[model samples]
Target: MKAFILDHYKKKGPLRFGDMSEPEVGDDDVLVQVHAAGLNLLDSKIRDGEFKPILPYRPPFILGHDMAGTVIRVGSNVRRFKLGDEIYARPRDGRIGTFAQLIAVNEADVALKPSNLSMEEAASIPLVALTAWQVLVEAAALKKGQKILIHAGSGGVGSFAIQLAKHLGATVATTTSTANIELVKSLGADVIIDYKKQDFETLLTGYDVVLNSLDGDTLQKSLNILKPGGKLISISGPPDPDFAREQGLNWFLRQLLRLLSLKIRRKARRHRVTYAFLFMRANGDQLSKIATLIEDGIIRPVMDKIFPFAAVNEALAYIETGRSRGKVVVKMR
Candidate 1:
């Protein structure tokens, strides 16, 4: 099978495309023939050794997190799906390799693809959609009549979050550039702050939740927008002690994470707001609900571009520019 392999971790390095052995399916796994894969900053972070402490992946491994494809075979223990089933998933952490021609995903992490979407569209949903879902629906428990601010509204997780927050009946505010103001508006963002022209902290206030996906400085600024008791959930940087405990890191790493996030966590406490870091995990059930939402037209994919499988490196480069309006996909079939 042809796949892109990462031989070593470097700050700026290219993934080498080469042949690799097919995956071995476990009793609780499903073998999928890859049709498309989604590109995410997490992919780049892993490649650059940024997440080495928590997610230590050895070199010479396939790299990708989101995939949509058909099932070529199912493990004997897999009863929910069978051969020919169209599915999509962000395979469980430590088990991801969707950039290849085929992958074996644990059945618990796979979900039936939304019937209304194409393979490329489906591929774009799992990682970003799941991130949004986990933050708004699961972690924050956002309610109607409340207000929530999602940073980088035109990006992958932000785009989906704005729409989902609106669907949950919350008033949505987001930050994006001038070129993407209308893009986030169409996604149902009630308040759009042009990050280039205006600072979001000055414009948004009394919000119930703030979803931060940027650097530590931006994450700190977000605290000012939320009201007392508001939830600040960050998907990026300075993993908190809670996250380290969730990953079951050793005492040394746990204390390290606590110190890393000490500043933001203390600041959030001073403001009387709750703060925590969110690292999205794979869940077939949550994805199934997302499928229903997509099929119902409540949420639609905001795709930036679809590159051929051979252009995987090019796709990663585009995402690194931080200019893509939405998700970037690689067509493998």
Candidate 2:
């Protein structure tokens, strides 16, 4: 099968496109024929070896995280789906390889694609939607009438989060450039902070939660806008000790993570708010609920661009610019 292989980890490294061996499906896995895949900053970070310490994908592996495809075959133990099922997923961290003609995803991570969406649109939802779900819905337990600030409102996760937060009845505020103000507004953001023109900290205060997907500086600033007992969750992170423990790292790595996050954690403590890192996991059940929301028109997919499969490198470059208004997808067919 033709696939893009990462021969080594280098900043702005190019993935080698070539034929590779087919995947061996486990009893709980489904072999999928790739139709489209989504591009994310996480993909670039992994390619640049930023996640080497935690994820540690050795050289010469395929690199991709989000995908929408058709199940061509299901393992004997996979009863939820069968051949010809249209599905989408962010395959579990260790098993991700969606930048290919095919992939074998565990049945537990796969969900039926929303009937209202195309393969490209479906491909864009899993990673970003799951991130928003994990942050606001699962972690924060955001409630109606509460206020939440979401950074990078026009970006993938931010776009999804603004809508989801509004759906959850929280007042949504977000930061973006002038060009994207209307875009975020259409996504149901109640307050728009033009980061280029205004300082969000001056204009906002006493928020229930703040979802940070920006730089360390932005992460630090986010803590101030929240009131006492507010949750400050970051997906771009100096991951906290809890994450290290969840990954079951050794004591050395655990203490290292503690040291890395110590300053921000201390600041959070002083402000009477809680700070934590969010690393989203794959769950078909959550995706199923997200699909229903999509079908019901409560949430819509925000699409930026779709590249041909051959132009995946170009797609990655575009995403790295951090200027895209929404999700960037690579269509395989």
- lDDT values of the candidates? 0.94, 0.95
Per-residue lDDT of 1-333 in model 1, one digit per residue for the tens?
A: 999999999876899999999999999999999999999999999999999999999989999999999999889899999999999999999998999999999999999999999999999999999999999998999999999999999999999999999999999999999999989999999998998899888887899999999998899999998899999999996789889989999999999999999999999999999999999999999999999999999999999999999999899999999999999999995
True-structure Cα RMSD, model 2? 0.6
Lowest summed lDDT over 10 consecutive residues: which window, candidate 2? Answer: 52-61
Best by lDDT: 2
Mark the regions of model 2 whose C-alpha exceeds 4 Å error after superposition. Answer: none
lDDT of 1: 0.94
Instruction: Tell me the lDDT of model 1 at 260.
Output: 92
- TM-score for each predicted model, relative to the true structure: 0.99, 0.99
Tens-digit lDDT track for model 2 on 10-68? 99988899989999999999999999999999999999999998998887889999999
> In model 1, which regions exceed 4 Å deviation?
none
